[model samples]
Target: MGAAIDPQVLAARVRNALPAKFASEKRMFGGITFMVNGNMLCCVSKRGLMACVGAAAEPEALARPFASPCFGSGRRMAGFVTVAPPGVADADGLNYWLALARTYVEATPRNASGQKRWRRKSAATEPSRAAA
Candidate 1:
């Protein structure tokens, strides 16, 4: 529980700021993560704007007002930062963070898909539980 904006509102803003092409979204880490070409660009959640600004840019991003290190599972997440609600209260503020995420994501290698590459076993592939 932090100074977070409504996830829906933030999600709408993200949709407006980023292009649909090469962008996809998924529910992860208790919120929705926007992925670009398979890499996480940013996320909107109750915790705030979780941005994947890359490790090199992490320091500068954290230096900005209302920005703090992003944490997951009680540990600091490298190359990510959480911008508090005040930091993204206005459209301009939100856009700024989105731009940073876009720049970083663009430079990364593209995956086969814009979504996670996790492989799930289908019913046919799954071991027969009854036999076990």
Candidate 2:
């Protein structure tokens, strides 16, 4: 049998290796997602590391030993790629995936409605306008 995985440790390692421009958020998917400039670049799930690469790179990634589609749908997860288990086991491999994610995130435009779609806070924070 394989060794048990520690999600917290994996998250910490990934967070430390990522560039300062990136930010991390704990996701309900039982993984931590790394975002660059407010855009999601990568995620660390129970399966392994996942990066958000566009469709162009999907073919190459799929042929890689530790690479796979980010989801089971068979359709490439937009802006996301799954890093093989071996890749997540070491710093070098993890760094490689992070670099790819960073590049993709930097090149892509920020989602127009991404913020409004994912924001969890209440609308009370908005300032009230005087009624006419």
Candidate 3:
């Protein structure tokens, strides 16, 4: 069997494939998130890539290979669908999913908590300026 993919590498590949106008951030979902205009486009998890393609397109997205609920079990993610492993093997497929995700996130409401939850606070440092 082929070597298992490292989620971090998968996430980086997806992020690098996105257009320059877009920006990406690593989040706590155990994945890397790509954003366009401050909206999350896609996320790459340990399993595969999750594309955000509105509820209307959910059924269709799910039909694709390796597609599944963003969260393994439990509540379903309304607009998110996972991309098959083979699909994410190259930039063409990666871009395809990223475009779909961008469309969905752009239309959806911003998750204020999402960003806040993932923000990493700087570690406390020893006194840089000694008190007199």
Candidate 4:
């Protein structure tokens, strides 16, 4: 059997690196995922870090050491890369990936469902000042 994933360790790092609010956690993909602005930022899986970079960043991310395409079923998962311990051996390395995921999550456009992933809750949920 493989090693178990430590969610507390991963979650603590994310809570420290990211803003206190606007981020939520959920259990999915057999791991604990950190979601930013309603979009998936990353996940701590039994394998390692599963980063949700935009499709445009996929090729470059794959070229990096210890990074490989995340797989599911019989297909390669697009826009997601798994980085093992060798890739994020230190805080700096983990921070680098966190930054990458943040940048992509912020820049990505709203998808077909009309859900705005990157918009802050304050802007989307609260009534506008003009309306008030």
Top-lDDT structure, candidate number? 1
Ranking by lDDT: 1, 4, 2, 3
lDDT of 4 by residue, 1-132 (tens): 234446567667767887888578888888888887678889886667889988999998889888888887879989999888656656887898888888899776534333654866766788888987
What are the lDDT figures for the candidates, one per model? 0.88, 0.70, 0.69, 0.79
Report the C-alpha lDDT of model 3 over 55-115, residue by residue, as the tens digit: 8888877787656756546777787787767777878777777777776777777666346
Global CA lDDT computed for model 1: 0.88
Residue pairs with clashing backbones, model 2: 51-81, 52-79, 52-80, 66-84
Give the number of colliding residue pairs in candidate 2: 4
Runs off by more than 4 Å, candidate 1: 114-132
Candidate 2, overall lDDT? 0.70
- Write down the TM-score for model 1: 0.82
Number of the predicted model whose TM-score against the real structure is largest: 1
Taking every candidate in turn, the Cα RMSD to the unseen true structure, in Å, is: 4.3, 7.0, 8.4, 10.5
Per-model TM-score on C-alpha atoms: 0.82, 0.71, 0.68, 0.74
lDDT of 4: 0.79
Q: Candidate 2: deviation at residue 18, Å?
A: 1.6
Ranking by TM-score: 1, 4, 2, 3
